[model samples]
Target: ETRHLTPQERVARGKAARADVPRSSHAEFVPPPKRTDPVEIIERQSATRVPELVPIRYSRMSEAPFRFYRGAASIMAADLAETPRSGFRVQCCGDAHMLNFRLLASPERRLMFDLNDFDETLPGPWEWDVKRLSASLVIAGRANGFDDAERARIVSSTVRSYREAMIRFAGTGNLDVWYAKIDADLLESLLASRLHGTKRGQKNLTRAMAKARTRDSLQAFDKLTETVDGRPRIAADPPLLVPAGDLLPDVERSALERQFRGLVERYGRTLASDRRTLLADYRLADVARKVVGVGSVGTRCWIFLLLGRDDQDPLFLQAKEADVSVLAAHVGTSRYPNQGERVVSGQRLMQATSDIFLGWERVEGIDGKQRDFYVRQLRDWKGIAMPERMRPRDMQAFGQLCGVTLARAHARSGDRIAIAAYLGGGDSFDRALTTFAEAYADQNERDHQALIDAVRAGRLPAEELPAA
Candidate 1:
């Protein structure tokens, strides 16, 4: 085992990294001569997903450049492989775009702001996540009709927040760093100040928080289920939400339910004894195949409804198929053999807290094929950010929150001292990333247009859904 270095030595090591890979080197983004076609990457990924739902994925991505960026994590993974690195590795949220940062409830029911999606998580260069996030801000800013200067300022401020936060974490104790979190009260105060202390801004924040609290399993039970013969069943909304029974004949459906029950029991074994016992109180009532997110639409996702004592006390659990991380092809395969376990482990490592039901299992589908899945509560005070609806100041404030949250997460798993020392008190890294973000945003627009062209031609099928 390597001996632990002194704090001064660690700082020196970080400074040494800058000589080998200067911080300014991150600004460069020239697509290689042999760069692979972005559309081809999407098609390759689609091969492993549900065939009918692939069109929905394509259609959703075709809506805007920002939307396309959300679904094109694989494409960005390829591009990120070509970027500069600080030689520091962390458990990265591989698709750490602006939208992936959101408000989620902790197990203690305290609201917190943190990275909500870990579908593409892996241990890789920390810069990859920073780049992904910075580029997303530019794309989102463009979507919101912000000018170039304003976009650059927002990206720079966000990157600066990350650098400054990392520096602070570097000076703090290990336990202190691990215990750090951005709770709801802190977020509200930051937002209030960032919004110029306006009453409308405070009111809007209050309304959004109130709305989030009502999005738990009970609320989902009301909106997503209906009483049928004195029993509750998940309502079928075809192409998006389809009941499992509707997908197969009676005989096959019965067998599928049996397999799902066994899978749930096996998954529960992976959780703590207390959580497992708590889960035992609820009995599975129904299962439904649900399409979720822009990139995740084609993946095999299931929502299970479980009843506790009576139909009124319901718990909804989601089991989402976990494929290999997009970063796997470039960085390396995960240490965990099961992809679902890979996701669960990464989430546990990075998040301040995780869902009580978070666990994994491998199940054989009705088609006799086996797949890995990570299970969690279907909904629990989850709130998503709307980038297109954000003003410049609002986006900037949201970006800062994401930056600090990401820094906290990285500090938990990586060399915080070296990373922070490398960043120093200068703004060189922040400005360089701003340049990189703009250049990558241009490249993203071109890629999005390519998808639109493919759909117009006969190359790709796209089914546009009705507006909500």
Candidate 2:
């Protein structure tokens, strides 16, 4: 059981694997050809114009992508109709899975946690976020080794809380929505109250809280930097992130710099005037290439670090690569002309207190490639919770918290009355979605395994993702 291969043997095995190109029987994905068919692209986007709700039926069972990525966009679009009975749709994160919610430090030094991931964020039905979040609970539960019946119970509880919270939001005043938050102290206390098994459990949670606090821009700087040849550059976490280079060729870099300047100015306008002043204190420090997330991995990304008078007063802004919204593929044309503009417009509409430095820009690469991106601070104070570690009881508690948070977010962004009316009364809507969530969880697991097989074979490269 403990046989160790010699270094020579390991090299030999690697070479053999490379030569044979091992394939898995279950893994069936043919990476689609680069999206061409401008006529089809135009038609799909044109189709997106219909106001009626689209349905997420079946994905083109391509063997190309081991996991669902852009294809999931249809799901986001389809779920839009599920918005609560009361509210008008708000700009939503578009992928508000429970795992995406996390803790972060606000400039005021308050420790807060909410929706922290936004790769798939967009303006969509407020219900889309809730459905996504609930579905994630079911999927994550299965991944955590829960039985089907248990997974259903978890999804039911999760969506029930989401439904109940929406009702509260529907009746609440705008002021109530604006002031809502679950700060770290209250969160820690709540967790402590719920995890009543033993003193050890209390201690473990307290330790976790402490760890979440130190997750800020300063922390990101240290982790991402190292001295190279007596100079500091971002440590290369290849295929995940790399220090941005100004090396897109001379003429392209010049034009890019000019466009980027315009972007900074436009983005600053998206924030409060006061926040703009704070950003002006720090000049751009460095920019680098960054790859992030399973869905967003291949998109062009840029990370910029800024310095104030001191390193402690730093700002990290990431200009993530933006692509055409999958929603557009079905929904039709956007009121906004540009996709980059659409993204920024959506974020401002959704988030209560958004980054002042939010803006959009486009530039042509030296390779004659055109890219669109929206920029924002890289790391202010950010916190992320490990979803892979939840027990059934913990999931219950977390699900309730997610419900509270989702309602607050949706209430801020969308029309609350229509959604509240749709949700009607009680747990019926919640139960219906819960049933669907359990079914989808099974589908997600099979897809995840497909991805795993692709990785095991030579089909996909191992990107530096957190191992579950």
lDDT of each: 0.91, 0.58
| Candidate 2 overall lDDT versus native | 0.58
Summed backbone clashes in each candidate are: 0, 38
Clashing pairs in 1: none
* Per-prediction TM-score: 0.98, 0.74
Off by over 4 Å in 1: 1-3, 250-253
Query: Please, what are the lDDT tens digits per residue for candidate 1 over residues 306-419?
Result: 999898999999999999999999999999999999999999989998889999999888689989999999998898887777789888888888899999999999999999
Error of 1 at 305 (Å): 0.3
User: What is the Cα-based TM-score of model 2?
Assistant: 0.74
